[model samples]
Target: MKHYVLVHGGCHGAWCWYKVKPILEHSGHRVTVLDLTASGVNVSRVEDIQTLEDYAKPLLEVLESFGSDDKVILVAHSLGGIPAALAADMFPSKISVAVFVTSFMPDTTNPPSYVFEKLIGSITEEERMDLELGSYGTSEHPLMTAFLGPNYLKNMYLLSPIEDYELAKMLMRVAPAITSNLTGTKSLTEQGYGSISRVYIVCGEDKGISVDFQRWMIENSPVKEVMEINDADHMPMFSKPHELCDRLLKIADKYA
Candidate 1:
């Protein structure tokens, strides 16, 4: 049996993996879901998070808890990619494979933050304005984080079934703004993270991170394999949990 450590995206916590975790556990593989500091159920407040390192504390702590002989498959989604990549670099021997689920696969020349900035810049001005108006509002400001309101959240994340959309509307939280502004830290090295197996799972209907952008990331940082869930939105864990879990199992069988 394989050990899978799942990381949630921005504004998300370990709670997001509710569906897939059970499926994986039922299949006899171990599952560990992480909520990065301040994003999920973690007690750390967003106002107290000062640096990117502080935000990554949960992932780092999880890695530290593992024994030397233990290795895990790191599954990351959305903004979780940044910390996952950093963790793979810092503790390559502990990670058997790194999976990017509709997430950025950053390179040394351009880290995940740079890729995120570019993703934001790639959107049309009209679309950007719409997103800002819909998801980000002044009343939710000053904490350096923003939340997606129901409408925006539905359109971007929960394009699956009606029930899934309703569930997300009740659960999503405020995501940090500074996750993409970090600088000066060393980037991934070929001898370190690059040596570990990498995989990318693309969510075809993802409006938040487009299919084209997913392909671009693969082009920049080649992976051992690529998997796709055609009907999924950005939150495939909620939208297409069965398919996502199946794909994860396949990857684990192949690489982990």
Candidate 2:
């Protein structure tokens, strides 16, 4: 069976993948989902994450535990793409391909934080809604955090089921704004992160990350292929799980 590692985005935990996970497992694939530091059910406080490395600990540990010959299809959503990129860079051989689903895709030409900064710049004040952004570290080493407000969550889950929306409201937590830790970090290496195959899955109706921005990202850092779920919002896992799974299965067949 092919292995699929699903990583959730900011302010979300592994629980967010509940719908998608079952479908993959039913198809006879091994799906591994994890909670990054201070996210989901992980007990660590957000303050404990001071750097990108600190935030990516859980995923890195999981990758490290695999056998040298073991490789996985790394599927990431939203902000989860940053950590997924880091993992691919560090363990290129361990990743068959990195799939970014309505998520930020970084390039080897800029620091890991470039895409996030572009996102922030593109979002208008009204578009940001009540989402709260804060800092936990001092001026010298500023660490940022984001908490998704109810209104902001609504827009993100507009096309999703009400039950899933309620579930997110109950489980969402304060997430580390990875841009802070990645500020001065060097860009991904061509010989490492660039060597891995990449794919982009666009959510055509995503309000949080607009389709324009998604296309911009794809153009900014080109990938091997691009797929779209025309009616999906930002939370396709909850809105279009079957369609999402179909695309994922196709990727597994081609790359895994």
Candidate 3:
């Protein structure tokens, strides 16, 4: 059995992987679904957490439990890519593969926000205004300004075909302003990425992240695996957990 660390994106928590966790465990693999500080049910008041380093602690602690050859497959979604990349670099030999699930492929110095501007469309003045450092306090992260609207079916089809309206509703929250921390990706690239292999999962119908943007991301990312999901959305774990789990299991099999 192989060990997997599943990281959730902005506005999400370890709870995001609830549906997929069981499938992996039943298949006889070990999985740890982590909730970064201030996300999921774990978040209390905003004041409870102050920085990204604080959010990354639990994952690092988990890494300490293993030896150099213990390979951990890190799967991150959306904004979660930032930290997962850093963690992979931190415990180089311990991490075999880092998977981005509709997420950014980041280097050390790149701010998760910086990648967003490059891969997705250019930042609008209004959007820039909303996500500006002042908008969300240096202490808080901002959630998505806009989402796939309520065409209901059509909306989910393109971006997050994983979630239904009700489930999608609970999954959202105000992300912290710590996105500014992503400015460090350049330094990360300077250092070797170490022993990790990267896999990029691109969802074809994702209107929120967009195929063009996703392609830009793939080209710039360090990894080579680009798995396309036919009609999935941003939150494929919500829309198609079963299929996602099956694919993830296959990836795990290769490493195990």
- In terms of lDDT, the best-performing candidate is 2
**Per-model TM against the reference:** 0.89, 0.98, 0.79
Clashing pairs in 1: none
Tens digit of per-residue lDDT, candidate 1, span 1-256: 9999999887778988999999999999999998898876788776655556677789989998999999999999988887788788878999999999999677876654677767866878655543432222244232246566666666676567787677666777776654344433456687777889999999999987889999999998889899999999998998899999999999899887
lDDT of each: 0.80, 0.92, 0.65
lDDT of 2 at 14: 96
For every candidate in turn, the CA RMSD to the true structure comes to 3.6, 0.9, 4.3
TM-score, cand. 3 vs. native: 0.79
lDDT of 1 at 58: 91
lDDT of 2 by residue, 129-194 (tens): 988998888877777889999999999999999999999999999998768364456998898899
User: For all candidates, what are the clash counts?
Assistant: 0, 0, 22
After superposition, candidate 2 runs with Cα above 4 Å error: none
Give the top-scoring candidate (TM-score): 2
How many residue pairs of model 1 clash at the backbone? 0
lDDT (tens digit, per residue) of candidate 3 on 7-107: 97765678778888998899888998877766777645434444555556667777878876788888988778766766776777787778888886665
| Model 1's TM-score against the true structure | 0.89
